[model samples]
Target: MAVDLFTPLTLLLNACLAAVVARRVLGVPVGWPRTILVGLFVTFSIGSAVTSFAEMAGIVTGGRFTVSLSAAFILIGLVTAWVFVLGLVVLVVLEVLAPTGTLPSPLDLLTGWKARRRRARRYAQIMKIAVRHGLGGYLRGRRRTDPYHGTAKIARSLRAALNEGGVTFVKLGQMLSTRRDLIPAEFADQLAALQTRAEPEPWQDIKAAAEKAVGRPLDEVFAEVDPEPLAAASVAQVHAARLLDGAEVVLKVQRPRARTQVTADVEIILRLARRLERGTPWGRSLCVFELAKGFAAALDEELDYTVEQDNLRSVAATIEGIAVPEIHEELSSGTLLVMTRLPGTPVGAAGPLLAGFTAERRERIAHRLLGEVLRQLVRTGIFHADLHPGNVLVGEDGELGLLDFGSVGRLDTPTRSALGMLLLAIDGDDAIAATDALIELLDRPEGLAERELERRIGHLMARYRTGFGRGGPSGMFAELFRLVTAYGFAVPPQIAAAFRALAGLDGTLALISPDIDVVAAAREQGRALMREAVEPGAVRAWLEERLAGYLPIIQRLPRRLNHIVEDLEQGRLSINVRPLAHDGDRHFLNGLVQQIVIAVLAAAATLGAIMLITADVGPMITPDIRLLAVAGGALLLVGFVLALRSLALVFKPR
Candidate 1:
């Protein structure tokens, strides 16, 4: 019977349904094999779908169709039932083999069914939320080439799903919002709201977490602790507190369930990212899985307050118009941070805070914010990774304060230098220089088309050189992300974080002063920083700090010089050369040279023989032989053979 008539289609439908039922009953992707049977089910499901489609096509084309839909269904059901009865008999064999874990992969039908068994519930929940929100198509990579490509509906839907997905997803969305290069501006704008507000954890849980983290009574740790959250977010919530002696401070308490909840969510995110990358075009281009892994690590670090404490202290002293909180290390732990409180409003919403501030003062504040962030990114090795408007507080005094050390990007000396160069080149419209600097900032992959990337960067520069709507750093950085993605390049996480921070600073600057041209201000500040850096005192300090690393070598320098001089003066200095260190290489080269010499000699011998034969010198050594002519002939033949052999040797493969 031709299975194309829908015979196999019915079997496949019945078997797949049976598998789904088993999974529903056992709480795993593979419960069908454990309970009833395996292969016949897989075979039936595949067979039914394939046969049904084929038969339908044959009928439409006026070709032979051996089976009716109803008959096919009946046969499929009967055959599957017979297979199930046989499977029951094999259950006894499985029981004996179950103890030894001997179930082979292919025989199991569904591969890696138990791989995610532990997280099956969360996995299912996430899938339901995504599907319910209609995010599957977007997840398959349907966004724009630029920030304008995403539609409002898609963005809104994603934001809603993220909100329902809980803390880790919300945080991820917030991070993506800054990455306009990776997402549409519509999506970025929508996701930014996820960071602005969320219901704070219950007061009871907050109090217990704070007290336990402090390892003392709440009263002992502070004069007063406010239950009202200063700010609520997914990772941690802040509270205003006062020290026992009456010093105002801020208390940052990690949410009680943040770690466990975020951990599970991170795992789910990683899985989703992996699946997207493997199955979708957009994921591969965006390097989605690597991005997830990087974000996961950053989220994990944020859960530990001690890391944030270290980050705060490291950047506490920098630039003139910015202030960073002084960490109270003695009372801090992996989950708690106590620090001096700075009074200010979020720069984005500093309505009343700007009352007394003059227009000039607001402009200065904007420059200060941009300059300070750039200074940290280029000059200092460690800088704030998250500099959103919510994280930067603008005071009445016009000074800005930084908050949230949970995410900071640290650059090694090389990366910092490369990034600094890259920014300066972009500002100057030197695309070639910018391309070179960008390469330095990344781990240069093999077979990269540097020239093509350079051309693309040049085009990007031309497009944005007039005026980047979103300001300089971010728009260009966003474009840069797209360019790298096009070339199949992945920006290292640290460098990417730094780029995002600078881009975010543009938004913060915009908040401080709407009229401020961020690009010009950034350019002015950048050159001014360069000037300040070259001043005598700053240069000397830089030189001194750098030279300190060479102290050991410096100490032995005079002695080394003296020994060199003495050796030269005594004529005892000698230079040793080893052009070819390996014996095999040397031998191979020597053979080549020998072959060349032999070829040349053979040519000379042939010439001499030709001259002898032409000159016809008179000589008689045998009665039947004309000695000169015959000798010439023999020499000529021998030379020809030698020349051919030399050529063969030269052309031979090893």
Candidate 2:
């Protein structure tokens, strides 16, 4: 068995060496991390191969075993020297063929093209080798006999496969599901069914991590700890426990070697991303290095118990009614997090949990939940990034219990401003401003054409408007994505994940009570937001002063216009308005200008139409634009009616 394993290991090492040569020859981005990993793999492979050869020699020599360690070292040195010499010779020959400081000869181009053609032809051969080695397990159906499998079975299979592939693949699957633009409906659908249900580390590993964190044995610290975990996730798992003082608590333990695995895997991924940067335009545009760094930071924070503890406290302080379990600081660390255990049933079964409550009471609870969400997102920069039904629970007293504070989002001042503006634009149904906010929030390319972006945003709004009545929640969400995709606007992975969490909440509410009004819940949340802005004596006074500041800007508008007129009279400012010079006939010139004007007008109209389509009603909508649109429409109607009467009088019999 050892010899069998060593043969494959040796072959793999040789293959890696081959790849190193290819990378140098092609000038591809095979970075230090890949080279290091390959080096380790090759070293191990060579060692294993040598051990197997020694064993075989021993068997052939009738158990004499005369091969010394020094002899093995000499053989390895000779092999290395031969490989190096061959590589140097190849390099020298290529250098001689090309001559220094000169362009490639015609023959070189022809040969290079031929080489590329050969590579393309050999691509299939490479794949075949992978298949031969069982790397095609992904494509091969494990249960091919289950042809009549239902959706649930298929979902299970997909989830199983994803879990087996590990964290990076699982995360990639989750990200792809949100990308309705790139992925097919079926794959996306399958991915949506996947949830983080990874197996927790053994109790011993948890205890070891806890000991490392608190600087004591589990028995010394905890009076009792349930051997079984309450929840298992990709990064960490939770278990109910009690402190030595008899305080009931829960322990969140990070998996052993998770950081090491993540570091190794992410390095590989980053190296691959760098390689892609040279191969694909989109890869370069995406700034994969920055993205990888951001992702690594986010994931590392998730593994940090200290971060989660702070997040929970921040959330509890910002959001009213909802409570997060208090963290036991003495027992907490980067790996082990101990918190007061709150009793509650999962929010999914809220009906049964809150069976004693009336419909009105339930509505109030819903409003509170919605209010908490809005406050966390709008009032506080730090918001609960995960808010799925599973993450929330309803206590016996009807208090909301928020769990899993590992993942949270932070918005900078600019993102906060953009978010506020986005909400305002949405409420007023101003598609152009909404689009601008979106562009700002997404950090869209500086070179992105403003007019085109506005048009796409309008289109998104249009989809929202048209789809709401006909398609309902899912349809509306899908429509919103269609517009995003159509415009080539990519939502960052975190933002996309946040949206998915919201969608899950929506789906949960739908399942719980069909009669519940999502939009109404949203509106109540909005009112709570406006109320929060005017909270105490100081806040209210500050708001009043800010309103006064705005009033002066509005009041000074006429004076600014007067100044402009005065400046023009004094020749301080010259008005220069001239139509483009037309060399063609009068009619043709008029028609060309008309077309240009018409196009501009059409663009403006399209923008308006888009806003009207995508605007959200109720509390989520800002009153500013809605009122403006209403007032504008009334004036336009009255003006049209007056014009018609005047025209009728002018064309009268007299």
Candidate 3:
């Protein structure tokens, strides 16, 4: 029996070792306890199944397997054990060879070779594109060595490289275009023109995706489907379709294999970001890893059509003025979204029409838009984060329509309150208050000088005051971002996204009504919002909610106080005061004497209790010396409490 059990036991042990190797050496995610349990079950089941099968096949006379089947099982277990031992040996060798951590582990070398080759191919492609566009010097670090020249050519080459590399690179370039503080102004301007539009997929592919999404043929769902796409992008394409119920809806069909391709590209980008963070000075300041993480999360959210649908519903409920297209939830899937087709002209295309509007009308439109934005920031705390002109539309009836609910911003109550305060401070020209508000919004890094930060903010605000009516809130925000970068504080991605959305809106508003003061408008609107938040009724409700949590404690306070006073009157309460300048040795000796006396008393009490238990010294209760034992136990308990208190005081830090 022992011999029979040995083979399966060895197999289980080998399986456990393999799991460890996969987890530690290869970076596989096999949780330890669960993996061990699974390994044991699998090993036992395999051995038992083989033996039983052999018995059923008449290969064994009774319950044992035939010699051949027995030998095969033993041989398999041996091979597994040998493989595990060999893996351990390889791990040791790799660790020894890569003591400086410059070399990959054996498992990584085997599995990641193809990934490295792919990465090299991509790098070569990027270099080729750069050289073809006369930006090779930039890629080779020559531009950094010299002064920045040929910014236009460099920006064009970068845009081309990103477009060629795939959706991940294009998305990254788009995000960087918004960050004027990080890149040069000219580069940012050029990259902002990088087109996100991709060539549309064929009609047959769209039809197939639609059919698969609705789990039926196209005719059953759509009466008339447009063969040509309405719009095409890196993620998905929109096509016009008429539902069977005569409702005109737009079908958003995800491109075939786009998710898989984007996933791979994002992984590659994340790896590069990690390397950059570890290897370069600029990378450390930029926080490339955190940026990559946020980008990945945003991209993942964008890839799911259902998330966009949910966002649309959420925004519709929160935003009152803006029009969001109603989604047909039953027809929506992970890849396909069906929504009522909105009827309006894009905000960018309405420039000629807007030019014809009266000045009063244009001012009203601008004010309405800005008011909605402020309300989103302060009241609703949910807003369209990507409000570029292309995503916004203006109807003939003067209603503003918001499109593409893929990206939305959310702010918690505290952040919303802080933002209101910041706007108020900026408008009031209280630079110190603005600085304080900004600090409260940020996770202030250690070693940052508060006075210096306030001074710098004051200087920036002074410049704004001198150049009043020049660039408005947008310019202030740009300068603030520069300051945040200069101070080595990692600006939160959400804050950056919010600023970008506001800046875009600011430019739009400028075009609509040049005379409108966005700062003053925001301040007035923010004050109203603040007042509403702290109204009497709201304050009363808030107080009630908070006080409810402490009601029990409040009710017990009187009784607790009475008990404390009684203890004081009975001389049972004592206070110990230790002076700062007291002699350390004398204090330690006094505590030590107290502890020693308490310890001796406890020991004597315990000894007395044992003797009382053995002797008939007190009135017997049920044939036991209960009275003396109880007295001794009580004394011991008192001594223990005193000893613990003395020891605690002796060791407490001064």
Better of 2 and 3 by lDDT: 3
Candidate 1, residue 132: lDDT: 93
lDDT of each: 0.73, 0.61, 0.72
Give per-residue CA lDDT, model 3, range 1-654, as digits (tens): 999999878987866865564345322233454445544544445556655544654455665544555444543453344333334334333334433235555677889999778877766776676587675654453443322366776677777777776777888888887776676656666677777788888889878878888899989888999988988997788999999989999998998878877887787778767866665555665677787888898899999988898889888999977788999988899999999988877777788777777888878887888889888987888888887788887777677888899988888877887888777777678888988888777777878887888889888877875443455665677778879777766666667767877877876777767777776666677777778878999899989998999999999999999999999999888877866446887777776776687667656765765665455577532232244654554444444444433333333334
Native-vs-model 1 lDDT?
A: 0.73
Better of 1 and 2 by TM-score: 1
Sort the predicted structures by lDDT, highest score first: 1, 3, 2
Q: What is the TM-score of each candidate against the true structure?
A: 0.63, 0.56, 0.68
Ranking of all candidate structures by their TM-score, best first? 3, 1, 2
Error of 2 at 54 (Å): 49
Candidate 3's displacement at residue 466, Å, is 8.4
lDDT string, candidate 2, 155-266, tens digits: 4555555555567546645655655544444556678666767877888887787788889788998899998999887767889998889999988888887776666555
Model 3, clash count? 0
| Candidate closest to the true structure, highest lDDT | 1
